[model samples]
Target: MKFAGIGVLNAARKTIARMLGNNEIAYESAKSQFWVVDAKGLITEGRENIDPDALPFARNLKEMDRQGLREGARLVEVLSVKVVIFLLNFDF
Candidate 1:
């Protein structure tokens, strides 16, 4: 956080991820853990009913035949994407 500085919200998320598991890194940030392969979209959970609030950042990965979201695949965070890409996409 020294260089980019730390946001309380982001930090809190990081801590949450650390506590949860490294695989859970994305959930810590406001980003989606999107795409579980062949799921058609970026939803965190592939199946089972979910409230919109449960995975708010999980951009739906539905096929075009399904309701398509224009800003699909965009989230404030994703786990371990390259630093450059992360910086480019980062937003408060």
Candidate 2:
């Protein structure tokens, strides 16, 4: 999936990470996974600098070729990417 920038990605990533790490224990026995991306393109180990929060989920996941760059790329600007979950909810 795609995000806006370091700040945006960091905020959302840490939030989701907390949600995944906490909510799973809070609600169920299973675990959860999350992915984030932004203007510098896809988040990966190859990228020198990335949001600090994004570090946890930065499993060096594969990147698609067109995952290019833009001066001011927003989440909406992501031309294409793999699926990303934004709002995951549980009854509990």
Candidate 3:
């Protein structure tokens, strides 16, 4: 993914690395891990060290070609149900 400049990519990588290495945060687990995907939906960072059992979204992103990632990327979370329905039905 393309970004405003190399600074963005560097920053993203540093953030992910920090999160992964942070001792106070339970960011990495058997069921959880970090990933950096670009605007075009390609994995930019974290692919090289990804685990095989990562979430389906992470695994899918890893399959894309990061060589062509672009700018305007944003963090996203995938939900099992319609967002509105899920939010309304959720308790607490």
lDDT of 3 by residue, 1-92 (tens): 22233344344435665767744342333113333333333233344533232222243433333422232133343221112111111112
lDDT of 2 by residue, 1-92 (tens): 22335355445545765766755462222112334445344445666654554555443333323455343334454434435544222222
Q: What is the lDDT of every predicted structure here?
A: 0.34, 0.43, 0.32
Q: What are the clashing pairs of model 1?
A: 40-61, 41-61, 42-61
Model 1 error, position 71 (Å): 3.0
Q: Which ten residues in a row have the lowest lDDT in candidate 2?
A: 26-35
In order of appearance, the predictions have TM-scores of: 0.24, 0.35, 0.22
User: Whose TM-score is higher: candidate 1's or candidate 3's?
Assistant: 1
Model 1 Cα lDDT, one tens digit per residue, 1-92: 01122243345556666766656454644243222211122334443543333343334445312533332233322222312112111223
**Order of candidates by TM-score, top first?**
2, 1, 3
Query: Which of 2 and 3 is ahead in lDDT?
Result: 2
Candidate 3, 68: how far from true, in Å?
Answer: 14
Which pairs clash in model 2?
none
Candidate 1 vs 2: which has more lDDT: 2
